[model samples]
Target chain A: MDLANTSLRQLASALHERRISSRELAQAYLGRIERLDGELGAFITVDPEKTLAQADAADARIARGQAGPLTGIPIAHKDIFCTQGWLTTCGSRMLSNFVSPYDAHVIEKFAGAGALILGKTNMDEFAMGSSNETSHFGPVKNPWNLAKVPGGSSGGSAAAVAARLAPAATATDTGGSIRQPAALCGVSGIKPTYGLVSRYGMIAYASSLDQGGVIAPSAEDLGLVLNAMVGFDARDSTSIDRPAEDYTATLGKPLKGLRIGLPREYFSGGVSSDVAQAIDAALEVYDRLGAERVEVSLPHSALSVPVYYVLAPAEASSNLSRYDGVRYGHRAAQYADLNDMYERSRAEGFGPEVKRRILTGTYVLSRGYYDAYYLQAQRVRRLIVNDFREAFEQCDVIMGPSSPTVAFGFGEKTGDPVQMYLSDIFTISVNLAGLPGLSIPAGFGAAGLPVGLQLIGNYFSEGRLLQAAHGYQQATDWHRQVPDMARA
Target chain B: MALTDTDLKRLARLARLRLEESEITGLQGQFAGILGLIDQLQAVDTRGIEPLSHALDLGLRLREDLVTETDQRARFQSVAPQVEEGLYLVPKVIE
Candidate 1:
């Protein structure tokens, strides 16, 4: 069997059935990563020795009859998540040499579940830029088309999964880091209800808007991964406190009676004709399954891009203040005084994109400008949230295109930050409203690139969202379409 | 609403970044174009609506006002460029 392309659930069963040893599986993936990742640029770092050690321990645990659901499954994580003893560069020069003292809560949970640590993947500097072009490490090229972008922030994690460098990976989405890239790469990924996954020790980009998520081959795999990664942690004040439920329990459940919302604004303008056709076709599949489709209007949809830019950057400005050459990162060699050292070190460490956001954030938050810009943006944010609330009253699920268009070539919009930010317009409002959202492969665009269909759910409805996405995956083969370049 | 080199320099300083003159000019052009597009948000009437921050409306749930600190000082300082006597070191400010 081609183990590299299999889902996490299937791999877990194979491990339990003695079809393959965890160490052997780890070696197979690590070897594949070594051979393929340089061309793909999916990983920022891969520690084979450390990876094999964890795999060995997992194999021993199974031998001792103590294996859990995720035990021995290999997964890479976005570099933003701090891992103790491993270099955690959030795709920026600022924390280039910084080694995390403690593991992020997600990383800690995965270790407890006996997951093999494959490596850390690349991303945009501090999870900014929608196309992965702003990364100080260099743009992560799409495996589908090397000249094209792989999508941003969480682009490395999405690319890694798409290229089969890792079976599953932990990714964080501030705006659309998880969902947009998943769509661009033709993979299954979900950004759970805000606070579903604890953010303790994860490098903060936008404090109020960031959430750790998963990217994998199928919605079933995403379900299994999300179930394992979520729960309340005392360390993260924002962590949700609901009792844990099996996220994959309804994977094969029928979609009958499910109310899918089709927002009119999403279908009109912006979205490519090919993407709209695919989404419309998806709605037909839901109809054939005895589900009902309702027309819903999120009148404030267009305002999401602006509201998010103001609020996310405002939080990011405050959060990123910790990186001032005092605690960690590159310090200036020549400094006459302490003040010069702090200023010069920061000026050198952070890249241009990070600087832009910090500047934009600081300006909006400055005394005279706060009420006019930051406060007003916050007010608009609530109106957008209310729009979602009224729509959810009519539909259990919201369906739309993940991005207005498919992956554009690298440098397509790097010069224009607004055009770059518009790439995430469809996915940002979920963070604003604190709702759960998922992205699954819908079909191919006119450019022969993958197109993603997004499923937005009411808050804490991750299970229902996965069930709908899984049902769609079962009937169609979109998720099964691998880029010829990345396949075996 | 066009951003100038002066605006770029001020914003860059507020962000603690030092850009070459060339980069500032490039950024100034890009920022001007972006600002022109984002100003459309001002047309909406959001006068009375409350601004939403967190997804869930729930307020902070305090966890027993207890102090918690880890002894990962050695691990934390391992990445610091300069350190001495259990504290980060920098050039003398009052020497």
Candidate 2:
């Protein structure tokens, strides 16, 4: 079997039928990572011994007729999730030497289902930046073009799945981290409703906005993995205690009479011509599949980027205060006193973008500016949420361009923080409103780079969103297009 | 909305980040641009709308006050920067 081309479902079937042992599957991916990842910079950690040991245990389970759907399946995890003995860097130097002593809820769930840890992928520092350039290890190069970045902070996971380094990867979305990268890498990803997935062990970025999700080759594959990922844990205060869901249950459902909302602000001159054309083409396919297009106005959309910059950083500043050269993470070599230790340790540990955000967050939350900046941003945040609620009244799912353009070259927008923040303009509002959103490869754009068509659904509408995306994937082959470099 | 050097220093101090003298000017420019962008929020009238903190409006869930966790202090402290005698070491605060 061509392991690289096989889907996650097909791999599960082969594993269950004993056609391919989990050990062999893990070794194949390990070999590929060894060969190709040197150029892609997608992974931060890979332990063959740990991987094989888990695979052997999985093989034992399958042999004993106790296998589950995810048993023996190798899945890559974004380094943000703390895996108990592995280095959980969160793409930052602060935690470079810190080994997690306990497993994150996501990791525990996957381990319980008998999944194998393929490796830990790279990401933006503390999940702060739009591009992977903020990563302390290095930027994850887009598999489609070596010079361009895979969008981040889930850049590594999206790039890995796009290159077939792993069938799927666990990722998190604070503001379009999963969808933007997935779109740029020509893969599929989903950020479920705010509290759908437990955030127990995941390192906090912006507690209000951060969410864990999955990046995979197809929307159908995302469903299978998300089934195991979504659950409640008392450890995470925001985790919703909803009944267990079968995320893949609606994958085979038809898209007849589905109302696909097209937010006018998303298409109103912000997106490049090529990306707009690709989204238009995808909409045509949806029309052919018996879905109706409805024009909706998210009038407060333009303010989302500004509001997000204020609120996300405010939350981040508070969340990041724990890294004070105190218990774990990086500590300065020399310090005059405790205050100096905190100041110098943070100065040395964080990258420019992280520092910039911390400062911005601090400025906004300061005494005089609190009412003007932080609180006002929160009030405006409600308007953005209400816009979505009103628009959803007219449609089942919203569709738009995931990013304004395709994968951009490294340093293209790095110098300007505002430009980089705008990269997530299309995906940020959903996070603010706590709605489910999915992005799938629609078609190729300028320079043959992939463009993604985003599908936004109301709260707890992941099943419908996946069904809509699966409908599009069934009619198109964009998600299957791999980069030429990975073919070798 | 532009921040002066003094303002920058104050923010850096509040955030507990030591900024080199040379990096201050560049950071100021970046901050000006970011603040200018977010200043757009000032134009919106959010007079009486309650600020939405949690997206789902979820209240804090109360739990039983019970000791559910065991002692893993050694394992947890293994990754600490400095540890001795089962305690994390930090610089002396009192002179």
Candidate 3:
């Protein structure tokens, strides 16, 4: 079997048929990670012993004829998710030395499905920045172009999947972390409706906005893994109590008379010509597949960025307050007093971007500015949410550019905070409105870098979104194009 | 509305972060840009609109007031930076 090109379904079939053992599959991925991760910086932790042990257990389960769809499948996880014994740093100095004593709900689910932990991939510190540059481990390089960033905070996961180091990796989306990185790295990712996936063990960034998702080679593969990832966990208060879903149930469904919403705001401007062209080409494929395009307006679309900056920071500040020196994170060696310890420990532990957001959050939620900033932003958030509600009424799924441009070089936007924030302009509103959004490789753009076409669906429409993206994937080979480096 | 040094200092204090003198000016400039972007929200008319603290409208789920957790204080505190005798050590607060 060609490991690099094999889909999750194919891998499962191969494993069940005894063509490849689980241990061999895990070893193969670990070997690729060992050879390529040094240049890619995609992984933060990799333990061959732990991986083989899990693989061996999976082999035992398979021998007993108890294999599930994801059993023995090797999967990488974003370091943000707490794995029982793995180092779960959300790519920060704060929790750099902290090992999780328990598994996150998502981690537990994957383990229950008999998936081996490929490794812990790196991420932006506390999921704060657009580029993986904010990660303490170092920025994950784009597989297509070494100097370019794999868009973050899930950059490591996207890079890992893009380079075929792992078939699929768990990721999270807060203002497009998963979709942006997936787009930049030329892979597929989906952020399910908020609360569809439990956030119990995922390290908190912006609690209201953060939702776990996956990055993989195709939308179909995403469905196979998401089936195991999404479910109600009583531990997470916000988790939706719903019946199990077959995320792959709608794959290969015909798109006849499907209404694709073209948000006039997203297509108006700011998008690079190369990206715009790629999206247009993708739309043509959908149009030929018997889908109808409808122009819809998200009148408050421009306000999404401003509103997200306020609410996310405000929530982040509150969520990150848990990182006081009293707990498991980093603490200052010497301090004059308790207050000094708190201040110095936080200062030493957090990176510049994390500190910046915390400060921004603090200022917004502080006295005298609470009603004006935090409350006002929340009110505006309602409007952004309403915009999607009104738009989705006239369409089945919304399509647009995931990022304004293709993957940019490291340090390109890191200097300007607003510029970096705008990198997620096309994606943040989806989170604000609590919708499922998917990004699939449409084609390549400037310098032959990949461009992603985003498909946004109403709440709990992951199945439909996957079906639509799968329809496009069936008609095109963009999702199959691998980088030369990955082939090496 | 650019933030003054006094404003930055107050925010740092509230955030429990210690900022160096050299980093203050750069942070101020960056904050100015970020806040300027955030300031755009002030122009939107949101009269009578209820604030949304969460994406979903679900109420907090209530479970029976029973302890579902096992006593794993040792396992929990194993990763603490400073721990002794089942307690996390911090700088003394008492006078």
Candidate 4:
């Protein structure tokens, strides 16, 4: 069997059964990366030597009869995360050649869980753009169609898993980064409630909206990775303290009597016809399993896009200030004075989309504008949050499309920043409300692109969300289709 | 459709971005368009509703103000394009 096509569960079983050495699995994945990553642009950094060493260690542990669910599993992380020995550029030239001396709490937890470090995937610089095109490195191509675009920010991570370069990869979402790409690339992913996963070492991007989560073959695998990653980390003041529980415990739970809330607003906007049909199909799967659909309303849901643009960039402007030429990023080789040097360095380091966010962020946060723009957006943000709280009172979970449409062509919306930002419209409000959200394959669109259905849950309701997704997956086969895994 | 030189420079300084006149014009147009869209939220009536930064009804964690020492100044500086002593060095700013 091709190890690269294998799921995390199968790989773990192979290691446990001695059918494949953990080192062999690592070597196979490294070989796949070597073969496919060049055209796909799925990775920014791949340390094969270290990965093999990690694999050897895992094999030794297995030999000693001590291995957990994820032990020896090879995975990658979005470039946004800080990896101690590797360069964590977050797909920007500003931090180019910047090596993180310490690991983010997520990375530390993965290492502790005995997961092998495959490499770091590419993303929109600073997680600003919805398409992977914004990365300084270049756009990541959709594995499904190399000519088209992969979804952004976490686009590289989703594409990597879709391309079978890695069985799973870690990703971050600040306004739909994880869910959007997972939708476009036909994979399963979850964005845990804000603060559910530690953000201590990930580079800040719109700090309040940013959340780290996992993308994998199935929700069951996502549960395994999340169990290792989520927990309180003192270094991150936003980290929440909660008792650990197995996320996969209810994968087999019956779906009878489950209340799935369908928000009218999520289905009313610019969603494509194919995407609507897909959402309807996904609903039917739940219905077949004895789940009932309940109508719900989030009056402020349509305002999410407007509110996110203001608040996200406002925080982005503040968080990105540290990258000034003076602190740690690139600086000009020659300058007449300090001001010129700073200006030139920033101009040279940041890309167009990133530069736009910094300016918008600055505008909203400016002295007189703060209250009118930033604070007002914050207040409207509460109405959106409260809307979700009210919806959950009527149903067990809220469902919608992860994005308004499927992946657009590469360079399609790059010229228009407003159009580009709207890609996250369906996904951002969850971050605003700090609610947990999940994206699973609904079905394929007319162009044969993947469409995602989102499930939003109440605070700390990740277990219920996963249970619902798991139940849906049990009733559907779309989640199991392999992507060109046997092509080569 | 594009930002004037004056607005560009002001926006740059506001962001603390320190951009050149050339960079400002390109950035300004993009910001205007983006901001124009975000302006739609202004239509929503949310008077008296508190601004929210998180969904949970939680308060900040207060920790005892104390130094927790774990130094690897050398390690922390590994990503710096240039560094000197225990601090990061930059283009000379003190006139």
User: All models, DockQ values?
Assistant: 0.67, 0.90, 0.86, 0.67
Model 3 chain A is weakest, by summed lDDT over 10 consecutive residues, at A1-10
Q: Which digits, one per residue and each the tens of the lDDT, describe model 3 over residues A1-488?
A: 57668899999999998889999999999989989999999999999999999999999999999999999999999999999999999999999998999999999999999999999999999998888999988889999999999999999999999999999999999999999999999999999999989999999999899999999999999999999999999988899999999999999999999999999999999999999999999999998999999999999999999999998988999999998988788998988899889999999999999999999999999899999999999999998998899998999999999999999998998889999999999999999988999999999999999999999999999999999999999999999999987887
Error of 4 at A443 (Å): 1.5
The number of the candidate with the highest DockQ is: 2
Residue by residue across A1-488, what tens digits does model 1's lDDT show?
A: 58546878788988988789898989999988888887788888899999999999999998898999899999999999999889899998888888887899999999999998999999999999788887778888897888889998889999988888888899988888999999999898999988889999888988888999999989999988887899889789888788999998888999999999989989888988888888888889888988998999999898889888788878988888777787788888787676667667877888878877787787778777687778888888888889999999999999999998888988788777888899998999888888888999988887788899999999889999999999999999989878876666
Clashing pairs in 3: none
Worst 10 residues of 1 chain A by lDDT: A335-344
User: Mind sharing the TM-score for model 4?
Assistant: 0.97
lDDT of 1: 0.86
Local distance difference test, each candidate:
0.86, 0.94, 0.94, 0.85
List, residue by residue over A1-488, the lDDT tens digit for candidate 4.
57535667888898899999988888888888898888999999999889999999999988998888889999899998898888889999998878888899999998888899899999999998898999999999888778777898899999998888888999999899999999888888999989889899999988787899999878888898889889999888788998998898888889899999998888775898999999998898899999999999998877888888888888888888777677577887777776777777887888877877788788788888888889899899888888988998999999989988887898899888888888888898899999899999888996788889999888888888999998888888677765674245
By lDDT, is 2 or 4 better? 2
Q: Go through the candidates in order and give the C-alpha RMSD of each one to the true structure.
A: 1.4, 0.8, 0.8, 1.7
User: What residue runs in model 3 are displaced by over 4 Å at the alpha carbon?
Assistant: none
User: In model 4, where do residues sit more than 4 Å from their true spots?
Assistant: B1-3, B18-25, B64-66
Can you write out model 1's per-residue Cα lDDT over B1-95, one digit (the tens) per residue?
77677766776677666667877777777667656655667788876788666768767787667668758788778888888988988767664
Q: Per-candidate interface C-alpha RMSD?
A: 1.7, 0.7, 0.9, 1.9
Give the range of the ten consecutive residues with the poorest summed lDDT in model 1 chain B.
Answer: B31-40
